[model samples]
Target chain A: MTLTTQQSKEAEIGKKANHLVLVVTNDTIDKVYPPMILATTGAASGMDVDIYFTFWGLKLLDKKGQTQTKIASVGNPALPMPNIMGMLPGMTAMATKMMKGKIKKYWPTIPEMMQQAKDMGVRFHACSPTMGLMGMTDKDLIPLTDSICGASTFLDWATDPNSVTIFT
Target chain B: MLGTSLATTDAKPAMVLDTKGLLCPAPVVKTSQAVKQIQVGDVLQVLATDPGSKPDLTSWSRMTGNELLSVTEDGGSPKVYTFLIRRMK
Candidate 1:
């Protein structure tokens, strides 16, 4: 009834073999959700999950970026209000607040989600070029970040034939 | 396969974790927590209401190197998902 050592070992190898690579290029509240959800779920499922943050996405890792992140209600058809209505100056804040309210019920706030992602073993990688472009240093970001990496380095991780990759 | 009934199953599970209404990582997280309570090779039964629980638990089982012996819907108007997972490690 018991599995042989080799059989169990094979199962162990399968369990550890999966990986998910997520690339985040936007820092908006909507933009961050996909990778956050993916990373947390992927890592939770026993797969290795590494997220590469580049350009605007790097801002989300900054200590105060999430607080200032806005939702893209304008030009978004999913919104109840029209694009013209979304053009109002306060529309972004309103939309962001509305999103926060809706998401708070089921999902954690941005900061909490970020913490949870880290707790789930989701590795955060800050793109090196974006770090310089944003004029930000390691000290500017949260401690959750594993390291600053270049495109080539991130590509190497995504290039793994066995791993699933996503860009958001 | 789970509808076969646990009584006729090869081995009984150490615990049953009901994750109805819970979504996303909740089911997986709870399963991980419950899995620790059982010994190696012991099974854990999870009853969930979330549709996502299917893929979630499936991948979780695979990711943890566990054996997913069965997955089936319970009899009723709205089907519930039941997963029989054996802790391989």
Candidate 2:
């Protein structure tokens, strides 16, 4: 079949770039790290990586809310303490601080990682419906945002045959 | 004599990246970024302390079309791992 110029251009892009698509739906520190780490490393490996932040995950894209993210000390099996103990006042803060201390020793903070990912050409997409649902406009998002897109647009990118989609 | 010949054949790095205290993925990330600073086919020498860097760098070079020419371990107190990678593209 004969291909038009636009079609061939898209075909060329598809042949050249392998895609890594991540759908992040949570905002906790632990939940946020995997997608960020994978996206950064995947981009380093020469993949075209995209992260679609929806629901709570979209909150990470917000400048104000991004800094407020905390590690979940309650109801987390990975925590050394019992759930009842985790209910104590300041437990979340203590846990978050402890985790941050450990991570800071050898790794970049989440915000720094996001910046590195952006520098490495990892594209960040904010969910359009979620933005409306949360009453957030583009001005509320961090400067790293690449696009505001709906699920269909994200799916179109994710549907590439060479792409791998991860949901967290 | 063998060591002398091997040393003579070793490719000198066009750039060096020190990621000694940094952990996994960071070293790889930094190496990827550093590789871009040099011309294609130039070698990038990366020094890292994370134990996982050996495997991570090996896989990264293989996946990114770069050549993993050699890996040297200092075996010091922190056990530094050094990698020489040639960017093919």
User: What TM-score would chain A of each candidate receive against the reference chain A?
Assistant: 0.88, 0.87
lDDT of 1 by residue, B1-89 (tens): 22232234456778999987667777887788788889876789999887888987876765666777788897765569988888766
Tens digit per residue, CA lDDT, model 1, A38-142 = 787776666788999899998878886856777887778888888899988888889989988888776777778788888878899999998898899889988
User: How would you class the docking of model 2?
Assistant: acceptable
Clashing pairs in 2: none
Backbone clashes in model 1, listed as residue pairs: none
Q: Which 10-residue window of candidate 2 chain A scores lowest in summed lDDT?
A: A1-10
- Model 2: lDDT equals 0.85
Q: Model 2, range B1-45, lDDT digits (tens) per residue?
A: 212212432789899999988877889998988999998767889
Off by over 4 Å in 2: A1-17, B1-9
lDDT of all the models against the reference?
0.79, 0.85
Candidate 1 regions with alpha-carbon error over 4 angstroms: A1-17, B1-12, B72-79
